[model samples]
Target chain A: MPILSVKDLQVTFDVRSAGSWPWTPPRKLHAVGGLSFDLEPGQTVGLVGESGSGKSTVARALVGTVPASGGQILFEGQDLAAMSPQERRRHRKDVQMVFQDPLAALNPRMTVGDIVAEPLVTHHPETSRAEVKKRVGDIMERVGLLPNLVNRYPHEFSGGQCQRIGIARALVMKPKLLICDEPVSALDVSVQAQVVNLLRDLQRDMGLSMIFIAHDLSVVKHISDRIVVMYLGRIMESGPAREVTLRPRHPYTQALISSVPIPDPVLEKARPRPILEGELPSPLSPPSGCVFRTRCPKAKPDCAEPKDRIQREGEVQVACPYQEVKDALAV
Target chain B: MKLASGDAKLLDETAQLASIRGRSLWADARGRFLRNRAALLGLIVLVLVAIFALFGGYFAKYEPDYVDFSLMGANAYRGVPSFESGHYFGVDFDGRDLFARTVQGTGISMLVGVVGALVAVVVGTLYGATAGYIGGRVDNIMMRTVDILMSIPFMFVLILMLVIFGRSMFMLFLGIGLISWLDMSRIARGQTLSIKNKEFVEAAVATGVRPFTIILRHVVPNLLGIVIVYSTLLVPQMIIFESFISYLGLGIQEPQTSLGALINQGAEQMNNGTLWMLAFPLFFFLVTLFAFFFVGDGLRDALDPKDR
Candidate 1:
């Protein structure tokens, strides 16, 4: 069975109108509208999207940081939305999250050892202090941090080192599933590779399932087993990582892939990439029908009609209806 | 089990690195505070004033309330500072030794300031953190209540409290504490509003740390720098308020005088040329206030995380 199966998950926020009276009605912001995905044990799913495409919201919903407004989140065949608060707390140990800003994710006042040992102490109060220390030390070493530096504060460390500390803290619980919310977005390029490689190594060693959320497609494609492309809170395309990046079916996915610059200067100049026009539509008032239609180059009059279904094409699930037309046009 | 020479050297170096001590946030702030000359001088003066308050009474020639009938009326000129007579600060209009009165007033003023500020910090931090963290309708209601309370004239409330509860040291602390916490709560709430959304707070929630624990462990500790700075500044304000109350004759009664009460009496007798009474208490009070302000300013610069 899949470790986590989210079916039609929806998250909405009530935002007050600017400069409006308190009595005025609040607008509904559909941050993650009907997102569904499954994570098998030890499988890594890369959730790629632009800013405000609800990528982080999906991670937040899974970790129970933000409440899911609708749908079922089945973890080990148990409905997370149906669980009591105590049960939810119990489940938190099995699922952990790594944040985007490394330093900001760590408590400035806490020692590195205390930060890493927090989850273990919180969940298993019966565990001995020696055991907690051993676990924290082991996780710190596993995350490429020196165990001797446990007394240091977050600010004393570099961004890369802080990210390592964050990773250690998350993995200290030995969680079955890890959600990384743009973990390396704030690091230098060299440090980004180190952290990503470290995460991949840790996953291989522990047989951990992960949901890696980022706006950088190249990084996502490098570390993910499968990739899910999202735009304006809806999945535009999802398939095997290699297939989704190489043979993108949806126009939106094709545009996203084309936007990635090749390393070789010659190939980078030769590639014809279509720059996406217009700003991302506000989540408070998202475009009708396929949310990507307003930005899609292959947009048709029918694309405006609301369609709640996603079509399957072999290994890929795509929201665009004109996949064949786009394919023919590409040829 | 013998290792290569290079590997052994590497291991030795690692041990040396491990043994190097780390500086905690408090340690770093203390270092910064020591480097600030103004703050260091202020702390030194404050300590001296505190020592005077605690031990100066023992050295006084007469008790604080001792009435000198010989120095009363026409013979009051003999009350001036004289090495032989041992009345270093002369006598007050009530025939009390000015030196003893100043020492006693210092102790009372310091106690009120510190105690009142402690009450404000504890009550304000908790109230504001709760409202800010819980947010939504609860925050609105809680903050609105603060606003309503803030609108009422605090001095009037203090006077009303003293009248209803009858004047006592504890009642004075309560009155000053109750009114002082309003501003503290507002500052705390504003800080918490920004702090609650910080990623560390979310990380704590994701770890399933209980809400109360999150507040105590994550929220409150992060607030320490600001709270400490604010509390130091608050101490002087508390002293001033207590002194004002005493000046109005509603505080400290007759036998037990405060700096404000002493100053009021000293001012009344200033035209009569008994200037030592006024000079002695005023000097102590002003020095104490300046010391607290300097310390508070130093703490703000020292504890500011951005400075690092």
Candidate 2:
């Protein structure tokens, strides 16, 4: 059974009018509409999407950071939406998050020890100060940070080291689920690989389930067992990482895959880069039926009509109506 | 079980961390502050002034308010400070010890400045932190109230408070503190608004750390640099305010003297050419204000993360 299951999770934000008219009704912006996913224990699910695709909202909603407007979030068979304040707090201990921009994520005023010890001190009040100190030191070392630097402030560390500190803070709680929201996007390319590897190692060692949200498909591909592609608050395609990257059915996913640079110059030249047309439409007024229909090359009149069905082709599930026909024609 | 295995490795690594000397943020800030020459000088002067206020009266042999009729019989009631007469500083028009009264005034002025600034810090910190942390509609309402309060003339509000409460020390302190807190609260609120959104606060919330804890530990501590730097600036302003009010006869009435009241008295006697009367009190007040300014500037530099 999946350790965490989200069913039709919806999140909407009310954006007030920028104009002076107070009587104007506030518009409801659908950030994430009817998003669903399941995370098996010790599994890494990569939620890949461009900015404003509501991928981060999904991660935040699961952690209860951003409140869900509708649908159910089931963790260990219990619905998070139904949980009381006390129960939700208890649930929070099992799920922890590592944020993007490591330096911004940490308190500049705090020492490394205090930052890592916060989770333990908050959830496990019974733990002694000495034990916390000892544990923090251990976690720091595990994350490749020098334990001796416990007293140093966040500004003293480099970007990569700061990220390691962020990871140590997240892992100290012994969380079953770790939501990494673009954990390496702010970091340099060399540091990105280091942090990603550290996360992978920690997940293996701690049996942690992860939701790695990122815009770069290549970055998530290495860490994720499964990949779910999102576009303007809706899922475009989802399947095992290998299958989705190799045999992308959705035209949107195919375009996204082609956008990633291939290292080999010869192969890069041979690759058919479907340069997507038109900018992403605002989430405030998304296209009817298929949200991506406006930019979708294969979008037809039927694609504009309301459809609730999600068709499965092989291992991947695609929202497009003519996905199978297109795949058969390609063969 | 897997977690325990990882923790076991952590225990072994603990030995390596013991050699590192942990430097607190305060200790680091202090180290930087000490290196600043002007700040160090200001600190020394402040310490000397505090000692002088506490015990300088004891240095003078005569009582602060003792009137000497014998001194009036002579060609001059106010005598130049002479060791033979045991008068360290010349007698005032009332034949009171100028040195002792000056010492007494130091205590009163310092008390008002320190206490008033402290009150401002407390109220401002709480008000601004709450406004910034809560945010949204609550923040809007709270900030609007601040704006309304800010729009009112400070002196008008102060005089009204004094008129209602009477010109007691408590009322004087409250009036100064109330006015000073407006700026402090605004600075704190702006800082809290920025810090409240930082990922550390979010991480604290994610870890189930309560709102109060987040404010106290995360929000307040980060604001200490600006708060402390602003506090130094506030002390000098408070002293000036006390002086202005006392000069107006609305503060520090007879018997108990503030530097402001002393300066007011000295200014009246300036026509008589008793330069020392005006010279000493005005000099001390100016010196104290400058000390605060120097220290405040130094602290601003010291506490700035950019400087480090």
Candidate 3:
């Protein structure tokens, strides 16, 4: 069974005014709109796209940090949207997040031990102090922290160490589903591989499930089982990681993949790489019909008309007027 | 061999636990604080002032305002120093010891300064923290109120308070504390706004840490260094206000000497050509005020995280 599933998740942020000036109205921006996805036990699903993809917004809403405007979040066949505060607090013990910025994410004043032990102490307050200390030490060791160094403050540690502190903080509970929101985005290039490899080993060893959010497709392809492509508060494409990386159908995904520098000179010179034509349309008032239609080279007159979403390639789906245009072109 | 292995493990565990309590927080703060030369000097001077206050009463045989006729004219035309051997600072016009009363005035001035500043810091922290953290219209309203209050002349307000409360310590506290606390509130509000949304605070939220505890534990610790620096800086300001009220005779009454009130008393000695009366008390107040200023500046420079 899927460990967690989200159906038509919508979150809209009311930025500023509550009332209307005749032309302006309220500046209600749609940060995430009608997005849906799922994760099974012990699986890592990578949500990949460029910046402002609403990828992080979806992750935050799943962890219940951001309030949902509409839709259901099912965790272990239970509706998270309907859960009471007490039930939600209990549910959160099994799912947690490690945000992108390490120094800002971890409290600067707290010792590494306290930051790691906080979740354990909070959720399982009944645990004895001795056990809590033991658990903190064990997790610190598991995350490659020197046991003697646990009392050091966050500022004393480097960026990568701070991220390790963040990971230890999230992993101490041995949570079933971890939300890694660009965990390596803020780290040094050399340290990125170490942190990524550590997470991969921990997931495999602990049978952990995660929804890894990142703009780095290459990094996502390394560890993710499946990939979900997001574009301007909506999912544009999702499929098996290798298939999506090798042969992307969506124009945005194609631009993103080709931009990933090819090491081989022959293929790098040969492929007809499409450079992105324009800036991503603003999420606040996205283009009607298919949101990506304005940016798609294959846009048709019918693409200007809303082509209600269509299913393609087994369970994969695309909303485009040119679905049959590609067919008619005999490619 | 198995028993020996268990004993080694137990020893290692005990050492690990012992390391956690290697130093108390008090000891750490104190050690860091003492390394700062200015804080050390400020602490020493403050302690010495307190010591003088406690013991000055025991060594005094005469009242601070004692009037004696026999020695009154003795110094009038002596053409030499008068023979009052025990008065370290020579006598005043009425043959009162300038030394003994100056010593007495330190304690009273301190009592006023500390009590007044405490009221200021407490009121300011609460008011500012509430305004900044609650934010929006509430912050706007409260800050406007602060602006209105800041514009009114503080001395006029002090005199008004004096007129209402009749020169009591309560009135002195109310007069100075109510005015000076505005600065504290502003500092606290700005600092609180920056820190109240940090991850630890969010972590506290996620863990079901109550709102009040979050403010007290998380918010307050981050503000402690700035608060301490401001508190020291405020002492001299409070002393100056107390001095002003007392100098104007709107502070502590007769026989209850403040440095301010005594400065007024010493001015009488100056009017009668007794320079010793004015010199001793003025010198004492000057030394204390300068010391407080130096300490305040040193603390501001030293405790600043930016300086590091």
Task: State every prediction's TM-score relative to the real structure.
Answer: 0.96, 0.92, 0.85
The lDDT ranking, best first, is 1, 2, 3
Tens digits of per-residue lDDT for model 2, B1-308:
99998998898777765677656667888999999999999989988888988999878988887877776634144466677676776766667777888898888999999988898798898889989998888888988898998898988777777777887888888788777888889999999998887878888888888877888999999998999999999898889889998998888867788999888888887777566677777888988888999999999988997876
Q: Among these predicted structures, which one has the highest TM-score?
A: 1
Top model number, lDDT = 1
Candidate 2 C-alpha RMSD relative to the actual structure: 4.6
Write candidate 1's Cα lDDT for B189-230 as tens digits.
888999999999999999999998998999988887898999
Q: By DockQ, highest first, what's the ranking?
A: 1, 2, 3
Q: For candidate 2, give the lDDT of residue B242.
A: 92
For model 2, the stretches where C-alpha displacement exceeds 4 angstroms are A19-24, A84-86, A324-331, B1-17, B22-32, B72-77, B151-157, B160-165, B305-308
- Against the native complex, each candidate's DockQ, computed on alpha carbons, is 0.72, 0.56, 0.28
Query: Can you write out model 3's per-residue Cα lDDT over B32-88, one digit (the tens) per residue?
Result: 666878767877787777787778767665567875566777744431223455566
Q: Return the lDDT, model 3, position B263.
A: 82
Cα deviation at B283, candidate 2, in Å, is: 0.4
Best by DockQ: 1
Q: Alpha-carbon error at B195 in model 1, in Å?
A: 0.7
Q: Rate the local accuracy (lDDT) of all candidates.
A: 0.89, 0.86, 0.76
